[model samples]
Target: MSGPITLRTQKALVTRYKNSLATAIVQGASVLANEESPKMLAIEATALRETAALVEKALENFTKTADGMEEITEEQDKQIQAYVEEVQAVVANAETLLIRIGAKRTGLQEATPMDEGRRPTVTKKTIVELPEIPIPTFDGKITDSENFWALFDASVHSQDLTGLQKFNYLLKALKGSAREAIKRYPITEANYAAAVELLHSKFGDKDKLIRSLQTRKETASARNSQLTEQRRLLDYLFALVTQLEQNGIVLNGSFVAQKILAKFQPDLQRRLLKQRVVQGNSEELWAVKQLLTDLDTLIKTEEQVSEMLPENEAFRGGTKGRPPPRRYETTSGQRSQMRQNLCIYCSDTEHNSLRCPKVDSARNRREFLKEHKLCINCGKPNHISRECLRSGCTLCDGDKHHFSLCPKRLPTALSSAGPTKSAYTKSSRTTQQPKRADAKQPTSSAKTGAHCINSENK
Candidate 1:
């Protein structure tokens, strides 16, 4: 007597009931947009999907039911069909409509298309932006490292500089030169006093050190000084790190420097607090220095054993530009090739004599002469003498013997007939001077003329 009772039928019936309930809930919740926690805004989505599936199932069942229920109540069947249609329409329309309303109501901004087709909407969805804290960056390192020591390797590699101080001055220049580039003004090896005048001009009279203190008091009273000083402190930290990094102390110096700064700041603040009560120079460099120790002490490491010397660190690349380790053992052939590649003995493009496996070992064979103590010019080994081919004579251990017995040093009759030293000097001095001078003048004049033309063009 229970109509079509089965688990399948019960499940369908439950699904139908759920679909109806979901639709009711969505319609009811739609009015609660004003209520916070905004639950209704999301429910509409679930109702729409459920309602679509329910309508499809309801239609299919209605088709099957009609075949069996022609004998049942016609009015009831029509009512069920109308209800399903209405629910379907409601779900379909409400889904699109509510979503559009929610998008507009929640302050979702619409974007204008820059060109052509349908534009994507751009809305400032409320995002949590964390408070910004400045950080030291690697780029600042490159700009601050202009000192001669920093630039020394580059200069030597390029053959640019001639002196060491010039190299140092160049590095010192990095602080001032990279002022705007660094977050904090560089604490240069720069004469701090001289920079004050410059900073005064650059930062304005308000930017001057002494003037800034008085203003800082006023700003602090007004609550702006708190912000400004914090900014200044941050800037100081950034600049300090930047300078250290340029000097090749990126990892080590920045950490230790920060530690010392942490130690120094509270003391500095107290000193400034005292200065606030007293009247003094608008700019305070001495008090700053007194509160802050010379960076020289900072140069010594934590152990105080040895300091970080710039030269100790590899200038161009890591520790040494030692290429990556070789995978295979070098063969004898490779060693020979390396020797050939690095030949430095002579201008001979043919072969390297220094490490050549084969060399001219005839008479003055270099290795034989060097080992056996023979003269290099004539080259007979073991006797230590130079032998000349022309005279066919061999002397032991020296070159003067060759000069003494030479077949090539005979005098000619014309050579003998030539003028004596005194007569020759008298004639040569009088005649050669004017002619040589005359010969030199035209060529020198031509060179001067060419120089003038080039200079004029420039």
Candidate 2:
């Protein structure tokens, strides 16, 4: 009973595959008979191959399902075998059709010599010639050995060349003591290996190179701890650590890390420590690694921020739209006696504005400033006192003016009331403090005397 039911299901699966294969074989055969073009034949051939694959898969499923069955009558076994043979026959037909289509495609491709009634395509390719790599010359300096060998190896030594050719190349790339070391060996095929080995021992010794790298790191310094200097120091340390690690020397110890750390300023050292410790990395090796990684991030960020700023941004401590007044120098490097601009007070170019002898009195200075439209405080043109960004007058602690132009620095005869105790004045003055602005008025006699002195000064 189970044999009949199991064989029935297997027969149904194989029957579907047999029908699919048969239908595909008919379609392929029709296309092969009607079409002589390779493209059309190829499309039918692909379809036949897919159908054949499906039929084979179904046959596998049928065999697997029958083997798992517990019992099968002799009649059912014959039926299963018949179904398998039917599916196999359809798959065979499909395969034979595919072969015929392939043969047809080959014949058509050979007969036409060109595809789709068009002339054969002549693809033009632009072959770019590359520049030849020049062999690197070495001057026998231990510091330059690594770079020299790296270039020579890539350009000449490791290329497809005979030993004699390589030997000649090595000769051309050597100079000074480097050429001298290999000069004894005659230029021959057999001496190339010996020469290379000798040079490696003298200059490229692993221990010697490692020791050189250590010396470089030990002597490295960034005293100012400026961003550019710090970046340079970081680059050297990064290269040193990489070279050491490549040579199988690890910087797990604090000796090298501490030495490198000592090269930076105290503030930078504290920053490195704080950043590393903040990330919970207390290991010395981790600190060194963190320092390199952090510096890379710091340098990149600084460069990015710098690139985003406008090129015309004014510098601090400088006047906008105009350069600060500067003394001129002669072609012979001697200081010239002339000022950059004519003095507004004395109208002479020989002396600076502040040092003008004729503009001695504060009243005259104020008159000159107003006439020239200069700032009353700093006495510079192009901006008023309120717009001045310069530091205040040191003599009076006044933010509105330069120290030399301060009224308080002038003689007391310039004003009868003396310097007022304004908010702009510094608190450190020991001179007598004048009455507040809101204080009771001075006596009529005192006011009259003040007016008389002011008139005499004018």
Candidate 3:
């Protein structure tokens, strides 16, 4: 009784409170109403007072029971909080009705004399006004049904309100398809229950909820390779598994562990394996729970490595002055086209054949482009070099060729194409004609000394 309560026990307590309140409301409906005769109203007043006292006692006991339980798992804590909020709403609504009934009974007693009694005396009781509880709305999402219905039931459905009143509240609280579904049922007192049943049948199906959770589980394991993604994936899986288990769907630990590992990148999968989550050489069983710890450690280590890289030059050994290359950009339409065509050289989807790293060297790339009958200027098919409209050879400002395969940037460029020009070209657009060689040639002594200095420096 002092320790943490089991889920079964908590559910039973909520069920008991709901059943009791429902029975009380149903049995005392006539007496709880405002249109009773003075004598009958006196009898009804006694019943209403007894019912109110019982409700107040029940609420106090419910609160004490919750407070007595020790703190446990996060899921348990959430359930407890939901239970408290739900029950509090129900009790507050019930108390509001009870106070109204009491006021009506008091007015009846003062207005109408009781049989063989002097003019009835009214005993005033202090009433504490309750703050309005905001009701949650539903937008036809299956995932939202659980939360939406819990608050809906506590504040509206199970309250002392009439069916027509509840129906109005229901209509106000729904939107999208949820409202449309209930709109078919006219807002009559009789149709309220039917509308509630219809919504519960459609969106509140237990099987649908379980399937949705399963779909999310599968998605969590699909290509979530980055540290941030993996961390979020693990946390999501933990909550997902907890929810599935709560619904009596137990997953196979080994199967789930293997499935998740198989979906990771090969290097990441190997690192996880090295953590000894999977034991035995041939018939290994995966410890699914241990995966969370290993994955967390891997994420932390990766973040640490990334943080240290900028500060430690030895760890980031690459070009010193040049910045890293910018990632290739493509519009959505271009990406769609690329997906259809792929890289003509290596069949890669991310880039065109001209940008393929596999077709190394300017000579090979140009050969591939020519052999495929693609435009040498832009590397796209269907047009000749001159006919192609794209500007050409950004590397050397040469005409009729792409910068990607420009011979100027290639060290092994063919000698027939002449010595590779300086990668640094003049920014000026004006063409300067070659100067006539009117000056005398340099002295043989000066040329020899310059050549000697260059050779010695090398």
Which has the greatest TM-score? 2
lDDT: the better of candidates 2 and 3? 2
User: Candidate 2 clashing pairs?
Assistant: none
Q: What is the lDDT of every predicted structure here?
A: 0.38, 0.64, 0.61
Error of 2 at 33 (Å): 56
lDDT of 2 by residue, 322-380 (tens): 66556863553233334344454545555455544545555556655676587776566
Q: What are the runs in model 2 whose C-alpha is more than 4 Å off?
A: 1-126, 253-255, 284-287, 307-458
- Per-residue accuracy of model 1 over 1-458 as CA lDDT, tens digit each: 22333323643663575567556556645543453333454465455546544554454454454435435467865655455445434444443444444543354223323467743433233322334322221222322223332343343324332222222222233343334432132222233334334433543332233333333322331111122233344445445444444444433333333343443334334444355448453333333232233322322222143223332231111112235777887998987786454422222334332222222212223433355453444332222333222223343333333221222321232133343222112234344321111233457889999999999999
Candidate 3 residue-wise lDDT at 37: 64
What TM-score does prediction 1 earn? 0.18
Best by lDDT: 2
Tell me the lDDT of model 1 at 10.
44
Cα RMSD of all models vs. native, in order, equals 35.4, 32.2, 23.7
Off by over 4 Å in 3: 1-134, 221-225, 264-268, 277-458
The better-scoring model by TM-score among 1 and 2 is 2
C-alpha displacement of 8 in model 2, angstroms? 99
TM-score of each: 0.18, 0.41, 0.37
Ranking by lDDT: 2, 3, 1
lDDT at residue 65 of model 2 (Cα atoms): 68
